[model samples]
Target: MITPAGTTAVGVDVGTTGVKAVLLDEAGRVVADAAEEYPARYVEPDGAEQDPEDWWAATARCVNAVLARARVRPADVCGVGISSQAPSVVVVDRAGSPVRPALLWLDRRGRRACEDRADVTGRVLATTGNRLDAYFAAPKLAWLLAAEPAVGQTGAGVLMANGYVVSRLTGVRSCDTGHAGLTLLADLDTGAWSEQLVDLWGIPRGWLPQVEQPTTVVGRVTAEAARATGLLSGTPVVAGLVDGAAASLEAGLVQHGDVCEMTGQSTVVNAAFEASRLRRDELGTMSVLPYPVPGHHLVYGSMVSTGGILRWFRDEFGDRERQLAGLDGDVFAALDELAGTAPLGSRGLVLLPYFLGERSPVWDPAARGALVGLSMASRRADVVRAILEGTAYGLAHNLEELGRLGLAPRVLRSVGGGARGRTWNQIKADVTGLPVETPEDARGAPVGAALVAAAGVGLIDDLAATVRTRQGVVRRVLPDADRHAAYQRYYSVYRELYPALRRTYDALATLRAELAP
Candidate 1:
């Protein structure tokens, strides 16, 4: 394939809810974008899995749609990049077929496996810069080896979701440093897989893929991939970072003291700092990993179910909103309007948005969602408002933790689906008592992936320079003093809910497991 002088780059983001592909021009403007949804199977209360093949199919569909929509020829695509949900375990055979369903980052079936190795907890944390938890891929891989030994025996290689797509695209099995850091198998200091950690978990070192920099050109789109996805054969494929890091890049968080709040299926609050400022105590609760930009690291806290909680409410309780949506109206907009009708603090109602347990600040896998202070006067809209406020409180909780580490944001750059809601953005601003900035382009991760692809192909000289030139804040929401004062009262109560119910949460988890078939 001959590349044109005016060629573009394609960035594909495989998220928890769907796959989004964006095509960007030389000037970093989005020429076209498309998205396709897929299902995450919840086999059990604490288990979440997805078919690797479904992700590949969604990627192909999204890429083809974006290319066709842009009216660009295959030869006009200069490079391709991918960003995806990380720490997801996909074990593949020698022929690249998945031996079993990929365990999602939210899957907690491996909690026992993670806890059984408590003896090496400090060593693992020191080596990987991540604590021992079911969230990391190593624990899930260990669980699979124990529960499904046959699959492990047949597994010739292990890859993250983005690596799986990269292998299908170019027949190269490789992972980026940002994604590798999440696996708990990589040495944070050396940026490579650790032999001691691998041996400690009893994982064959051969099962892991090679680690590469986020912008490195790992391979080219092969003939088969071209036919399936409509991308040009031999187009350069860059190793991409995880979705949160990519979104952070797009939010221009390379500079110190700049924080990004990515509100998607999950809300990730990340602050960047020079590598010299890394501390061990903070790593016990949050993740401290390498950023795509060299010499900088990202310290982030993730809430596993922020936006997913709203989706749960919309599906289970918002029947009228769904019917309105069927009539060519926006359901989320309607829900937002309903939430707007409620008073601040939802008239004494408070909700815990831990629908899928939680990740940051509170790493308890056994935690569950709860709605407190409900009364007969409470209406559905109040519940809706409580959900939104609850999520904001969670964001504020993460921000407080970051503040303790002296990495708090003076101004939070908000990006992702939740940023689109004016009411919700204002709620976040009020709850966090910080100014919230939203970029002109809400397609956060995909835009960042495209920027990385452009840099990888030599179209852009520097990632930070390109971001500064191309990205701009279109809107800013400042904190309302009155509203912030009111939210602070509820926020105090919100902070107490989890600690008050810790023992109850554990007991309920035990009772539920005992009653399960």
Candidate 2:
């Protein structure tokens, strides 16, 4: 197929920490990108919220900056796509203004609501291919209905993050199929809203948005959105996938047995498979949802604290590194250099990175972080290296569980901020004894959105073929035989720490709750 001339697409990703916008040309190369940050309010112990207006403002600023920086004309941008964090609750009134701050996917305020539906757990699992947990949308909506009864009575609809953004841009209410799966309210078999589940939750059918495929052009930019984002009015807008699925698509994990590992605030590993291959009962804590590609599904697992643990260390213990960063030096680079000096196994020290409990494989909410084999001879670098190695161990554990379910991935394509660090990717490869591949553009979710936009506007014919041709791997990390052998011994011991200390974690949690003032 001959390539279209003078074509470009804009992709905006609304993430937990910030919003990122990327401009991609016909060949899927990033022309320019910009990011804007916003605060996530954590007023209550288990609450996390963000202003929907803030996301809209950031999206505008990011998109404008990308176009200006790249010197691209608005007319050249033929299409726009949006991807965002999923399962969030963004209540909008009739005029499309937010009724309340969005409840983030990380918020746990809906735990009670999730627990109230325990009787139908089996049916929910079978119908939705997901567990009934606070992480899903139904529980969050239930919490909103009880906490803010006025909004429920009068609101126009409750949408996910990307859905809300799309509404603001085009005056349309719709969500992609991939994100609808996160609601625990969509029927996997029929690929639509489940009236039974929605009625059971007591939420009005009007509250849910219309569901559409990922590449569908749901609407065009309104004059207001055009003025705010510096894009031409009437530009096509595609209904994009959830953030994780977009990353998977951009990483070229479109076929069965293809896998992608996203390492950012958390570690999410997704493997693609045919829809018929989904075995609901065997997927313990792993979510099986529809992939962007038709007739395929994504089986995935997550660890709540992967790069989050490393960030905690950098904030609390890396004072010297922070000072260096203030002087135009990179703190992570300094830490990486220091960790490289440490020997294998960090001199027998092992660190468990469960600072926020865990989600997959171990699925223990009471699990806590631990530092074992600490000695006077151990230097700060040993602790740093141990943190990196510990996260790799956790990844290996989840991979083992996926293997048991007959979804083992042959090679893991790595993406996210961690993929930029060669040392970390190499360490993960060594610990898991699997080859790791990094794409030329590690920030792939937004790029994937742009690709979806291209396909939506008929600029690209075949999605999978376009991805394979355009997105190339920049680097490959292969596990060293000797290092892999050594890691096996340490990983064996690492696997035992959680089981051995489960009782202790429970005791500490109980005491803390009992002693609350």
Candidate 3:
């Protein structure tokens, strides 16, 4: 139980599928935490979206629940920080209500916009340090501007998930620099939005929210927000970061060469590196974004389906296990235990984890998931174990891409829901041939947001120094040499399957699109 005497800060993360909030004490301990889930609407075959109001509502519930569970005085909460999945974006009206559901990162509808505006590709890539892909905010924003009838240019403002929530909390619109860097609009070198790119999108300067450093205090919680969220009316609210960057901080990414793997519904592998040291051309494959700490950056590769695949399998196949876990109990533990019994390589079964297309290295928006080497003898355990191995193989593939660029991280510090799966973590360790370390608090981004709040309110000096001090690597899974060798051989086969089946994936997408009622 949290005692009232000590000062506490609140951290909130509005993730793609849920919101998690943590009560963090001054010493960097997560005293209490709460989470609430909301769903994303699969708009069509290749589209995924969520109501911005759901994000705010889920965030409010989580914050209030955390405070209530801790029984802490609202005044004792020194500050609040927030993080969210990005560069997912939503347009809002003057009253801060969503014009439509947010275009989540999983949405692939922006591919049409990207193809239509190919002329700006070169400048966009150079300016943003990322490709003009459907997976990013600008293309999605452009698509929405053209497709969303309610999103009028005169009244709508583009905001990332966190920006919308920040507006509701403080009645002030703000975008964190960390998210801005990936919008395909921000000039990475200048650390600000590129007017040229925004002009290319035909979006007015006024339509974009002002971007601030993640630790900068943008505003105080308004009385109205206080009533809704249980925060002090005047509590400081910092401009928060992308969830991946925040998770990096929680994983103890303090310096250049430090790496973190945020293994949530999706997986984002980040390797911290000084921008000055690496040239743009050298890091072309992955999305490069400014790290939460100013003057720092990370090269990130996002795998769209990692833990989500397991969740999909559990929802579709693990019915008995799910029922046995009961209400509010995790079915993943039982699923993991079942998968653990399967041998390494899952008896030659391989899975393509591109259920939502893919990003980083592959960059194929039409790519779909597949299961290979399946025979009549295949068991449910093999399929479950294969899912874990498949994600690990994808991570290995990403590491190989990083290896090409000379940033194969030595020790991967992991944080997220998937990092808790012993079977999955072990598979990641063995497949990547890197020791996988997980922090004590698996609720990473929220704690990282709390640290950001603590930093904004002067509770800590030097975000990097504070992160270094609060370093917590509770468990480390090292690779088994024999299993690693066997997996590498299987991974080579996994690599071949994608290229061989690339044409079929496109054909499948076309057929599915045509047949949809």
Task: Give the lDDT ranking, best first.
Answer: 1, 3, 2
Task: Output the worst ten-in-a-row residue range by lDDT, candidate 3.
Answer: 1-10
Q: For residues 1-517, what per-residue lDDT tens digits would candidate 1 score against the true structure?
A: 2233336989989888889999999888889998877889885558899999999999999999999999999988888889998778799999999999999999988889887899988888888889999899888888889999898779999999999999999999999998889988889878999988898887888888889988888999999999999988888999988999888887888777789899878999988877887876565577877888777888899999988888788878999998877866667878888899999999899998888889998998889899999999999999999999999999998988888888757888898778888889899999999999988877879888888888888878788888777666468999999999999999999999999999999998898788876
| Candidate 2 least-lDDT 10 residues | 1-10
Top-scoring candidate (TM-score): 1
Candidate 3's TM-score: 0.96
The prediction achieving the highest lDDT against the true structure is: 1
Candidate 2: tens digits of C-alpha lDDT, residues 349-465: 998988766778776656779999999999998999998899889888888878877877768899876677677888999998899998877776888888888888878788888
Candidate 2 is scored at a TM of 0.93
Q: Lowest-lDDT window of 10 residues in candidate 1?
A: 1-10
In model 1, what is the error at residue 383, expressed in angstroms? 1.4
Model 1 misplacement above 4 A: 1-6, 327-329
Each prediction's whole-model lDDT (CA): 0.87, 0.84, 0.85
TM-score of each: 0.97, 0.93, 0.96
